[model samples]
Target: MSSKKSDSEKITIVIVGGGIGGLALLNALSTSIDPEKHTVVLVDARPSHMHLISALRLVVSDADDLLNKAVHPYGNHTFRNKFAGNGSFVHGSVTSVKFGDDGKGGELILDNGEIVAYDVLVLATGSSWPRPLGFPTESRSAIEEHIMARRAEFSAAKDILLVGGGSLGLELAGELKDIFPSKPVSIIHRERLLLNDTYPDKYRIAVQKAVEDRGVTVLLGDAITASNSSDVSTSQVPEGGFVTEQGKKLNPDLVVPTWGNRPNTSYLPSDLLSSTGHVKILPTFQLPAYPNVFAFGDIIDWKEQKGAAKAAFFHTPKVAKNVMVYLDLSERASTCDLMASRRSAKYTGCMEMIMITNGKSRGLGYFNILWGIIVGSWLITLLKAKTLMIGRIPSQTGFTPK
Candidate 1:
């Protein structure tokens, strides 16, 4: 097949973006057809998402799953053995895609400056965020450098300013105060609540008390206008939000923006995607517009919540199986439609997300069921640490995590 041709030929499916959903899709692809039955290439727009996911993870599970879902661009042999046993990973971004242009059907215009032919395309590029608000760095070296800088800032500063009041600010302040005990760490939020007022009101109030009890100062409804943009990225528009109706500086030693994540699909066209920014798919998890294409995980804005509590590989086994079935035989659904079961959904955002602070021993978990809540368990913390220390992707496809 050449770069562009307009007719149906032997299906060569090319998956773009190797994040959690992408990897699961690829892993699903691994067992779907024979080794060489379909041509496949997993494309990552960035060099990797390891640091990006890990930093956000500290605020989420802060545990074993981060490394399991991370990607190694340079190609670690052990990591390769663990994850990419059969899949061929290519390092390049899809600059443009031409449909039905190639003899086979379509082809991806990659940044490496090559034409990648495919009959079907699946995109699962997740979103991105910034420091303290999101992952701190892109690579291991950058993270190490950041750790050194933060440690220096920790040692020298009398006051540490936590700029945002979301989970990042809450977790960082609580952990830092716990570690230093006497050092002043103040958390500032532009609004009144710590977490949004959406959950049980008691949840936010209790968390605020817990954070305050840790000796972290909480300042709410205060806006910080920068003295100036001393350092701003050239490509980025004077990107900032604190110069309020009246100018004032709620100067904290640091300012981090954590609320800048949406479904990551800018690389994809607007038509194939739904308003929520995830790819629109039919009930079977196959792209109705493009049946051969399949997607799930963070990219599918389904009835399930994006977090692991709901869409864990264990919960959506049938969605995965259904995709497999549809791929092998046309228009056939799997025996079980687990995706349609929501009455006993048992998976919701209220499901506990075990968020650990920098203090390894201490943690917080948001649980839907009261019985599932626990904190400061050394055994559980130890298990999480071990898994992240060595990257371990879960073998299961999609299930609600218990």
Candidate 2:
């Protein structure tokens, strides 16, 4: 990174949402993009990056330091030093983008009434999960308060019911059981299997068995009626608890819904969005109408399931390469040449891969490659069950894990 280039002479690359994808792209650009030619700016609504991968563990466990470990502040000296003279982190929420007629470059209008100009833009404003998994606040203290409140709720509950049997529901059940051994935790999945049909039945069965082995009840093939399910924000069961479609009434002290993650694309234009609210992008991760604008992470309409690992490991490098190529060709290349470069660098898709942890010592998962290899307890514990990859955040952000 160099301080020699004047601001006017450099290309400003603005990225929205400093979640896994945005941070990964920032790290990539920090290492490879020319500092003298390009100035990078990452804007996030939150004060720090909440490692949502380990969120369940943080809230469920009694450990006080886990919350501190789960949050990685963008303004921290370590992160600031990483981007020293080249890039900067902005704290704001984007309300809308004012793109030119050609959709080449645009100014982003922030909710706080600030405008950020960009020569190239990247949207990675990830999805929002249910409570305990999602942070609705922006300030660090408010976020901590939210976590502490959820922790208190879990502590006071006589029994907990996890309302969807996705990865989040399973992981939350596991964490609760691991922390409070006798705390009656149950998972009620609408589907017959633990997960969706993305993986084979064997893997789903293995997950359910692992969860059941931990003494957590696994109720499948039944769903709570809409009348019993509360607002989307809380998704709590009513006073008498919820009655499943199969006529089983569960009266748990706490009900947490783990399904229904909406992409943070409300601020984006409808033209750039799919019917499902995800940004429509070409294989190169660039918007079809706005070539200079790119998107990835859970916010993009990629066929594959969204995960932090996918964004950090796969999408980051591809998007970074394409952005660099676009920058390099902006000065001299013809439209055909630019399109050719983008077409040559592309991400076709990724296979279905998921790992579910059951308590700290047990779990099950499968990778679709090699025809869906089922990973057992030991590998799951070693990989994710114990720490939930909390250390990866610091490493990815150029800091040593404590």
Candidate 3:
């Protein structure tokens, strides 16, 4: 919708769930969406900037003073609002979508029974990955940031077990092993080999060699299921079994759920998606038969990726274009492929950087790009992650982190 319009007739675009994908889309859509012609409603059940996790490659000079939190600890609300700008971050769960004919209009029902009507709906409700907070993106930015720092605390520990030999687990375990060779690292996986679907033998070979060379023990192909039956639906607990199909138990100090995510699609109206709960998208990137409705990021299962794999929120321009097209701005809709972008991400998660802890003198780096499954060093564990951004998100009634 164009910015020029009467306030009363302005079309509303309702976005569900504020994660990497939702927030990124909101950031991109603000300029393109005319506030007069369209109102964007972004909903998530968390305090503003609550679940955005970050690891600073280098600490902000005055972050401690401005955020009122230690440089190593997570910042408070005062910090998050700065990150979100003036974006509308709601802290409420979307119950369901009120389905309508064609793709023109519908209502989104929240758990509070609050009904919101939208000219177009974008299901940017990303998936929930299993982690300490259940959903990796479900905690406050400060809290999750602190968790990354928590890994720093382990730099001096003597022995550690890294489970779930997939990319996440392997990268984390191997990185830690590389960064802290003083500590013995042991990896446990349910499968005989790291998931075959994720990589060819070469990458796995690289990961294995890197980790093993670093004195990390790689336990390949152990089948394990959820130890507890009730945990099957919740995101907090692992499937539970740490045993191989042969019944060998691989124990570790901490086990991270590396991959696997349940999409946030169930929050939409049942009729809005197929039985599987994924919004079926047409080739043009619009939700099947729904014009005002579109999807991107972890929600659309176009590729059979776990939520973690599809968590990149970089594909915002194309999604925004489709929204504009639905508003009658263009004769034809745009496509949501990465190839068209002038600047693009490599789209893989494994970079070799040094890790540091206990005030930066200590360091480790992975010679290989893949997590140090095989040939990593202790330096890989402490410093191989994120660079923080500049900003804070203000406190809002609905923008609470879950």
Candidate 4:
């Protein structure tokens, strides 16, 4: 593909996927650089940006008050009021990217046959989870309905079985128990420990204890396989419970699948992707062969645990600086080894930090790399449960926080 003729002298930066990383990068570039020199365009398939972490909490809760707060439209919120007229939002899905011969610039072909050219490209499409847990939907009402349906299922069920012992599954179990204390809730994890072996032993043990203390049954070290049982009706609450590889049977009225997130990179070239389907980025958050092309958040091949906080607080700032350096070099024609000099220092895999809450009250938090200290329910509630940071989304999108 060849570069298109430009009407203006300004360089164009096209960022795909308006997730946390993309929004942060847009914010950083908009605030740091002069609008006259650069034009920014954000492309996303969804009409609104969904605060997924907060959505998780909302799905399990009985209150419907926070549904509108969890989703924000990009046109009216992120790129509408901000950007100072230098940025535009495209509501479409990119089918593929065609790079220029120089590898510094490219044109993105959207599914709707629209082609957008860019001097620089950023991939922050992130990942997708299963429906009723995490999935892409443009309709806010659809998501609210799904949550309400799931809530009804949870309430009507006599026993609830949550598949996967990861943080999400555990949190769901805790929330279910807290909301419906009389119902029997159990978490079936394949691993022997909660949250797998990635975290420290102390934190795992503490989390297991905290979850079990909430009256949630913790079943570990068993691989669960779902099978249709003749004894259960097709329209039953659970459909059917899973049986362990060890021949253990668990029958619950409701079964919620809550793990595994597939990276969203179908539009990217195969050569630019890792074996696991994630975009391959260097330490500077740039594509290995194409420095002008950057990626971060859950879509990049970073080893750290993926979360909104990690992307917003850590990865986006580094990517912003790298993009700035690239733009500076292009403008000045200087021969500075910007990537070499500004590569992000290797991130030492430190102690894992996470706050898992049952509801608005009980929870568990783990912090401190040197000392694995487990925080009580009150601290977790204070940190996340009370708000789930839903109140911060408006300000995060450049609007006044309500």
Candidate 5:
């Protein structure tokens, strides 16, 4: 618990989670820190980093090779070769983190009972949603089976009800309409506006109009409640259309929940968490209780919409630089000022940019910082829906495309 590593020893930086923020941090560290001084470890429960946005289309289309396309193996030869002696990837879920005395880093307790000690810790575990929307399985075959089963359900159902009018709900509704236009697709969102409140009114209206134009029924400002019982499972398909809080009833053959993401920070210390269970980080992206313990992405309590692109672009570099400062301090302990280094590595928030697509063809994009510019379907399709930025992940992580 002394939280000290000798200068001769390589500083171990354990990054818990291999999602966008974690992997980006690994890539950034690979360039910033010298291998002789530091060794980085990328840890995750999954064997591959999933392109979740790509999986949305796959769920609707039932693409046979989507598993291959959407998931990129962390054990890729090119990615491994780039890190070489500098870093390595570990496949295991972190069950708990045992912090060292003060804010000087600690040990990661893996679910498999293995312990990983770290000089610096980066928690980028991100957030989780209901399955089929998000792949919960680590194995490729398991994910394939999950998707196929969902596809079968979609195929058989005549009426589908998607709860929540957020981007995911709208996108899934649109995809269902595109694939099975004959089926009745409806979205029941508690909010009158589409998307979240973070977005401007014009942007939300544009998305609502676009989704409605796709022939999908939009039910706004009504919360879905079970008519008889409050014990309705979040993932359960309703027996009959559930009533709203105001006594309106809706019946759908299949109900897919598409809102709210819980942060994957159950293993984090309670003091570091917000009331909502997300990790609380300073503007420098470091936890107050543990400055050497940096966190970002959806897991952090940043008041903004969470997205993979945003995590990769904004959070990763700031974390990598701060970690490097710690490493450098460990090396030149006599000279470097830790306080100055932490202050210099401040992370001012990023601009609000979002692209929500309705399946393959149409969607809306908004860059609020850029004078509230709105992008149309063609731009959205070209930028995201067509590929879901799958290629970009591999490129950023230094993995050759399969």
Candidate 6:
């Protein structure tokens, strides 16, 4: 299918990826952008928005319908109804995108041979995670099938070994122990501490304490042997038990590597990206070469740690404001008034604040302030652990969590 604007004067805004960053921008444009002057199209591979904040909880959860809450279908009236007549949500994986020779507009081709033309393009495609946390970029049913199978593995496994001491590894270990209390859960990390040096040592110790309090074993300053771990599909655990670099042998029924991630920039052009595959953008979030192009979320080469909170709060507003400013500059023949109203909308970065839920009831929080402020479990549970902020989906993206 192709996108055809009813009026030639209307600007076509094509946004790629329906993750947090994409949805936030969609909400901004759908509500404020002039329907008569511009059209919006959001393209995504999946049929629904996968809220992965609570993904660890879902895997260990006995609740069958928790998956429903995690994945909100695009067919929901709350999401589709919000769009103006010209705005829409298209489901397909973008194979490639090319801006027009004039650099004013461009067109992208999907895997299914559909072409989508746009006056302005936004690349919000986030990172690709492991199974359970991430699903196949196919239909909603396919994703559900994959998750259900992974859940079965979690249920049947006698013991689980998680590689990496990152936030996700810690959370997964906590969730497993929480649900299956008797099950042996262990985490192996290359670093001596539970997390990286990004946070204070005090905060990292607190995080380790929180995980250990739940009887989860953590082995620090160690890594899986190269013979066992491979470069391809790190998420795919080794078949049998493996030996650590320190020569410690482990035999867990399920092995999950929770380390390393790559941005979903394979479909993007190399010129617009850094050496690491992250999109290169100016402070305005627009591509330096393609002024009509913008990128956000995990795909952008930003200094901040990639998370839903940063994408929703910081990147969304800046891109939304700048997109409109660009549109006004494009539509108006006069430049003086538009230039006066223009704000570059710079994202300077925010305080390093982390709220990690160990289980349904216990967790840890930290804010990188003066020295550091370590919040208690009660606050963490109250804010994130209880529901993982799933209830806020409707208000944030106009889609009910279910």
Model with the higher TM-score, candidate 3 or 4: 4
Summarize candidate 3's per-residue lDDT along 1-402 as a digit string, tens digits: 745555447676776755556655665666676554566666665543333332222211222232232122212322122222323445567776766775557887777777777777777777654543342233557554745544554543455554466654554553454346566777666665754444446545655665566677877765345563233223223334345556775443344444445666777656656665677776445665565677776666364443321344334556666666556532234433442232222222223322222112222222335453332334433332322121322222223232
lDDT for model 5: 0.75
Better of 1 and 6 by TM-score: 6
Candidate 2 lDDT (Cα, 0 to 1): 0.81
lDDT string for model 1 (1-402, tens) is 655322233355576765555655555555555443444566666455443324433333324444334434433221222233434456676777666522224777876797877666665656554544233323555544554454555556565666557665665665566457797777667777776543445556666777787777777776444443332111112344335424543434444443335676665678878887887776655655565555655677565435432333642554556544544553233223343333112223234354434344444445556644434435434644223323344342221223
lDDT, candidate 2, 1-402, per-residue tens = 855779778888998988888888887777777666778788898878878777887887556477777787776443343356667778899999987655457899988899999989999999977887778556989888888888888988998888889888888888888778898998988997988887789888888888888888989999888777663248455777777899998888788888757898999878888899999998999888887899999999988888888988889889999887777667554456547564547898877777788767788878988767998889989998787787787866655535
Q: Residue 333 deviation, candidate 4, in Å?
A: 3.8
User: After best superposition, candidate 5 residue 25: deviation in angstroms?
Assistant: 1.4
Model 4, 187: alpha-carbon shift in Å? 1.0
C-alpha lDDT of residue 51 in model 3: 32
- Model 2 — which ten-residue stretch has the worst lDDT? 75-84
TM-scores, all models, native as reference: 0.67, 0.93, 0.64, 0.88, 0.91, 0.92
Q: What is the lDDT of residue 171 in candidate 4?
A: 76
Model 6 gets an lDDT of 0.79
**Location of the lowest summed lDDT over 10 successive residues in candidate 6:** 75-84
- What ranking of all candidate models by lDDT puts the best one first? 2, 6, 5, 4, 1, 3
The local distance difference test score of each candidate is 0.51, 0.81, 0.49, 0.74, 0.75, 0.79
Off by over 4 Å in 3: 1-6, 50-87, 133-163, 174-185, 225-243, 251-256, 269-277, 304-314, 329-402
Q: Order the candidate numbers by TM-score, best to worst.
A: 2, 6, 5, 4, 1, 3
- List clash counts for every candidate, in order: 21, 0, 61, 0, 2, 0
296-376 in candidate 4: lDDT tens per residue?
888888777777767787888878887877787777765266544664433333345788877678778877566667788
Better of 5 and 6 by lDDT: 6
Colliding pairs, model 5: 241-250, 241-251
Top-scoring candidate (TM-score): 2
Quote the positional error of residue 222 for candidate 3 in Å. Answer: 1.1
lDDT of 6 by residue, 231-321 (tens): 2134445555677899998888787767746799999878878899999988888887777888998888978777888888888998998
